[model samples]
Target: MALAVCVLFDARTERRIRELWARLESRGVHTLATHTHGRHHPHLSYAVLREWDLEAVHQAVDRLPDGGPFTLTCQGTLAFPRGRAALAPSLTAELARRQESVVAAVRATGADLHRNYAEGAWVPHVSLATRAPGALLPVVVAAVADVLPMPLVVNRAALVDSGTGETVVLPRIP
Candidate 1:
């Protein structure tokens, strides 16, 4: 439904998150692993754009300085309206700056930024369950708690289309 500039986790980190997803899925909780499209990657987004020019947005982001890879510690789970649940990561100054830079670059391309991703409103998180009902909160919480304070290794970046699950891999983490 939107295009997101996201930082993807390394294989190790991805596997760990996937394991949690599997556990939740087995318990009848709908996680990203089997969410709509069923082709989601384990990632944390810098920004989600309601509209954008793919190539222009890509070029703009590519022009920015590389922030390189970094690690994020997810200490707890965050539940949002409409049954969305995610791992809330501790924000580092570098991560904030990188996100700001990406937002600016994409906005420069005339992309409409999703309000949730606006500068002052952003909340950095790696999504887990896409539609976890209130009845499944305990399951989601317990699954996440089992992996609390997880060290997430971010090694790549990309522009992913939420509707089609298509990705345009970025040259660097910006």
Candidate 2:
């Protein structure tokens, strides 16, 4: 499996992600998460783990000079050629620095870095879909149509560890 160091946004921010999904889905953009299969949560991540150094990441995060909350905007929908599908935009400077600090921490552990998703191609977003939701595409489109340009306030960030590879909440940082 791949190891990734990711930051889970606080709940208030998560709600905006869901709202965007709903708005986009309502507008005919097929979503990644549907009622039956998609369980991936709404959050921004630094990188998808090719190799993860949990301890190092935690340490790096601890060392990162605190970057307070910053607002990020979601413009539209996009599909990653790498098999992900969702809505997101470039992260704010604060978010990017925080993400980089985590990466730096992971690198300190001597684990091979797989990918740096925080770079230019990294679009900070709340993913609404990934893996085919099959026949529910149309339904998804109808659910999120109106809220395309929702401005979400990111109040906090967290280092979420995999809980048996299931979505789990961990301690958050300000």
TM-score to true structure, per model: 0.98, 0.67
lDDT of 1 by residue, 128-160 (tens): 888989999888989899888899999999999
Alpha-carbon RMSD, each predicted model? 0.7, 4.5
Query: To one decimal, what is the Cα RMSD in angstroms of model 2 from the true structure?
Result: 4.5
- Model 2 alpha-carbon drift over 4 Å, by segment: 19-39, 116-121, 132-145, 162-174
* lDDT at 1, model 2: 52
Local lDDT at 126 for model 1: 92
